[model samples]
Target: MEPLDKEQQLERLYATPPVYEWELIVNPMHFRTKFACLLSLTFTFIGVGIFILLPSLKGLMIASSPIIVGSLMYPWSRYLLNADKRHYYAINKYGMYSTSEQIIPEIAYTIVRRSAWVGCAICVFAAIFIGPIAFVGAGGAALMSFTMTNFRSVPHKSQCLFDGYAKLRNYRENEYSLYTEYYHYGFDLMIPESKLMSIIGVIKQYNDTFEEEFVDLYKDSKFQARPIILEIVR
Candidate 1:
């Protein structure tokens, strides 16, 4: 085999760092529990308020409101849960087998903005209802909103090796890409697809040794002048 270059050495170090046991995180945000609480509490309060206070509904809200609110909230919760599952699975279970190289800034922006706006709208509507029951429902909506906005579990929870950077794939076209938070310039190393097991070591080594070098190298560089590369490791 050809001797590895300095960059290759660094990449290898990151992909296969020494470790005892890989940490597996499931349900990192506790969203499953959070959603359950939200649904249960919102319906519980509404059920009681409508059945006892109004009495005309005759516990109708308990039976029917759940279906209505559930129809609206379930889809949102399902989407949020799926997003969380994808992220956690990648980091904790799959161990970064393959990653897209294009550090698309637009993708992150769109995801964040859309999620935020949707969450904010739900919370705002709940807030406007205005009553003790409204307060409880609004609280549930607000929690869901905050959770959805910050749903990605890996980076936020400090599991990834490098912090990522956002790049414009196409400025006028609005295409974008994402990069490791601290990456070296002129040294794009995409791990081979068949070498999936090596990624854990690679990430571990990269974080342990060269994280500082990677960050310092491009910390002051002009954004318009950065080379983008992606790695697809086994």
Candidate 2:
């Protein structure tokens, strides 16, 4: 008789339905944006120093400082707080993908919206503090600040393979809520970090010897569907 394997053991336990089948793809735009935001925020602090501590810019400081700070810091803080949760998957015969940008555009929009309000509020504050010079200085700073803060990812040649607008979906199970992004690649996968059992389950389902339909899913196995799992050492 053949040796009983781990996959065989799992098949006997935790019976899963076909319709709930999922292929997970990890897209790390959030992690990358978090790093970028942190860097941008640091630069914003430097700009603040130049505005406040530098004696030469004292006359223009109030207006410029808020503008510069708002422009840079606002976007940085916004993206940091609201960066999207993106995932990629292929469902049935269709390719579907989603990203945080698609799922929570309001979160991103709110950041910019608040920054715009800050610019306007500073303009009023400047008028109260000084006069025309203050207003001009404050307004100019605010405009620049707004410009820097609200910058977004534009579709251009330089974007990475994972960078682009993708589809978004929301999942609600009992009390848990999850946001997912699906990227439609003709045939590309973004591997995600998940629980060891979850990963094994996907592999077992796909590699099930009882089913030959799994092989038909991908035409090419070379770069297409290479097994990512090995024996779990326990």
Candidate 3:
């Protein structure tokens, strides 16, 4: 038989009705406060130092632009990206499929507006020090930064399909999440504690090679580490 193409494979996978399905609403502020504070403080210091060194009205605007934009946009972006959004997942005989709701237009607008402001700040800073010629270099840098941001911001896969046969190991990381790896890819499943075992049972039915073992999720030590044993207790 001829090899199936990407579209065909996806069609075949989706044709199988899901045995189980679930949804999760992620907390926008989950484990992010400390990191956000550190980021904001570092930018604040930079802006302050720039103002002190230049000591002018123009310097004030140039320096404060990023700080102002970052302060407002970071939280707004996070909320827009995650608030009220539901991640959907389904499992069948072939594999598991997952997707999340997103506000594409709002997300794109925020990213573009923030990147433009930061780019303008860079251009102004450069022009003050290096004259008209600096605009060329600064403009190039800004474009490069914008391109890199867009590249990173775009989601590579709208829906992720994980093949059951390809799964290598599964680790339970508390009541809310499960971590799994296969070959070069690793994924986290946001499954409720109550439904976790049932989902595993469905997967095991399709994948005969399924095996449970203890392994360190995080390798904190090179010489010695305690491994967490993962198994289904009847």
RMSD (Cα, Å) of model 2: 15.4
In order of lDDT, best first, we have: 3, 2, 1
Error of 2 at 183 (Å): 14
For model 2, residues 1-234, the per-residue Cα lDDT tens digits are 885464553343223322223333222242454556665566555556545654454455553655355455545554543343333232221112222222246566566667666766666566666566564335555565456456454321111111222222111110111112322322233333344235334433433221111114334444331323221211
Which candidate leads in TM-score? 3
Could you estimate the TM-score for every candidate? 0.30, 0.36, 0.63
Model 1 Cα displacement at 181 (Å)? 29
Candidate 3 C-alpha lDDT tens digits along 1-234:
997876886786788888888766544344344545656565556667667866776566555544454454444345443333345677776566777554345656566656666666666665776556543323444454354344223332333344444343444343223223443444445555667678778867776455554455555655422222122222
Candidate 3: lDDT over CA atoms? 0.53
lDDT of each: 0.38, 0.39, 0.53
Residue-level lDDT for 42 in candidate 3:
57
Candidate 1 achieves a global lDDT of 0.38
Cα error, residue 47 of model 2, in Å, equals 3.2
Stronger candidate by TM-score (2 vs 3):
3
Candidate 1 per-residue lDDT over residues 84-139, each given as its tens digit:
22111133221222222112234554575466566566446544543345434345
TM-score of 2: 0.36
In candidate 1, position 30 carries an lDDT of 29
